[model samples]
Target: MAKVNYPEEFAGFAITDTKDWNKPKYITYKPKTFGENDIDIEIECCGLCGSDIMTAKGGDHGWGSITLPQVVGHEIIGKVVKIGSKVTLHKLGDRVGLGAQAFACLNCNRCHNGNEQYCANGVTTYDGKYPDGYISQGGYASHVRAHEYMCFPIPEKLQSIHAASLCCAGLTVFSPLKRYIPKNLPNNEIPKVAIVGLGGLGHLAVQFCKALGADAYVFSRTDSKKAQSFELGAKGFIATGIDGWEKEYFDQFDLILNCAIGLSGLNIDAFLSILKVEGRFCSVGLPAADEKYNVSPFTFFGNGSCLCSSALGSREEAVELFNLAAENNIVPWVETIPISEEGCETALTRAWDGDVRYRFVFTEFDKAFGTGSA
Candidate 1:
């Protein structure tokens, strides 16, 4: 029997089994029909995130609600190919990007107040349920359909591959950092900022802090990334594996962006112990295991430090980060892989092994899926 094809079908890669890494197969799936307020983008590049890891390796610890045979690349960059009747935000041939989110209930308070990322009725780019009862797919495909509101215009100065990662990784760190910085402070007033990991998010955080006139520091397990950290504008490097590493920097940082992937061997109390009075420990990393960090109540009260977390950023924040990157000539350190079945498999395996420098972006989607109509 011939498989039934929907009116709107796009080619993409998906994994059917979580236990098998070699199981990602190219497939065609139907997207939601174009609405008056929507636009369709022919994807140019898509960056793989740690969240993709969690989504692909499904289990109790991973994203639990993901439907099978999911297309899971959220950090997307492309050119708008088609726009609906009422889509005023973008037109045909406009360069655009979509982050981790697809749509939000515009009537919600959070959406109306410019915090749409927290909208209770929000839909994610992938593994999400849309209002029209269609499962949301992501940018790891030749074309992506999205509501116009979630589509951000990519800056002319920002490269597509870089913009793809920034749609999520850059915004994740930029949102909280921008919110925390005091507006009255002078540009020269160096706030002490520490980035907890040297991977995708932390690398971008270092650049953002430096561009925002803060003294950036990197806390890592070894000196392997020390040179790269300094090159990326870090003021200092602290290897936590070294004995008494936190003693010298006691009450040092104004804020710590905790971007580490896991809490394994991380002394949360000790990290919090070094915060200045009223300092913040903000986390953006999603752990793969059900793990808890040991922190005493006194740890919070003693240093007057607070803990907070941020997820995929709001549209406003994404724009702000994009503008900041454009102004500062900020670019993420990424390794681009040409889009192919074998290449994607290797990229996923490398990401799983924690081997990439920072980010893995898949490019040449048009060639991968045959030429897309733009």
Candidate 2:
């Protein structure tokens, strides 16, 4: 193993107050004490997830009240600078990525059954606490410490910038499509899958749907994203803003994956209307706590469609997702920004305004933190 000096304190751009959360200030903080199953990572790049911005905003527009001096980022890609004695999944100097989740009880039935992401005792990568009362920080930093099980080895074929978003956005959408789409369909019997929204998660969902042998369709508010959706392997595009738009496609889709955020205006009845009987409408987007769908018990009476949501994927699914990306050459549409106060503000503001083409990844870590990149 390569010998490298680990830092006593990790530094990151943090939200000191909800008033100015988007305007993060560079600060140094202590991480939890190293444990037998933990590994220290030297962050190279971290993706800008919607959750990061929402958590920063707090109050009505955000997740909830967050711990002060919180560093919010979860799609983390870094190099293992140090590994614990019991760590076998990763090693010193190995490149890996950590997503929204940081830890889970490995002894649970859910963990054993490939649903560890839903483990009742699971911990998130940021704004989460350990049993020892140590607040977990995220990667917008020079270094982060996490349990080895939460880290996945990056494939050689994928670039760090492209692989960063896969840690969260990619995994979020991938898990649902992978679960609902059948793999044993005959070559001519391609399943028609609808991916709502054309942002970070939706774009990737289209690609994964195609990669999984399904005919991908994109459902957006307008036709503006039509061409781009097709470029991302979507076979069709549905402009849901038009009146009675769901009429033509009624009972046509095998599955509808709602990747749209801020579901306050979403037409649940219309979306569920298109699904074939017994079809699934799975959502992976996280809107504000108050933004909810007004679905009644009668919502599923027409088609018998099942409405559900998926969390971040499991460790086994993460491994499969990376391998699938590598084999299919799947790359997220990402814009790289240097990690700095000004840069973070620019990225978060644009993302909140829906100005980004797809995803934003923070790079130039060495310049920001004075720690050499791996």
**Residue-by-residue lDDT tens digits, candidate 1, 1-374:** 12213236887888777775434778898888788888888889999888887887778566555687888888999988888899999988999999998888878899989889899998889888887789988877878888899989988999999999998888889988887754454555678888999999999999999777788899999999999999999999999998788889998888899999888878888888888888899989878656666677887987889988887777888888899899998999899998777877989989878899899999988778774544
Error of 2 at 294 (Å): 0.8
Count of backbone collisions within predicted model 1: 0
In terms of lDDT, the best-performing candidate is 2
Residue range 50-120, candidate 2, lDDT tens digits? 99988888884788878879898999999999888899999899999999998998999999999999999
lDDT of model 2 at position 349? 88
Give all candidates' CA lDDT scores.
Answer: 0.85, 0.90
**After best superposition, candidate 2 residue 242: deviation in angstroms?**
0.7
The per-residue C-alpha lDDT of model 2 at residue 141 equals 84
Itemize residue pairs with steric clashes in candidate 1: none
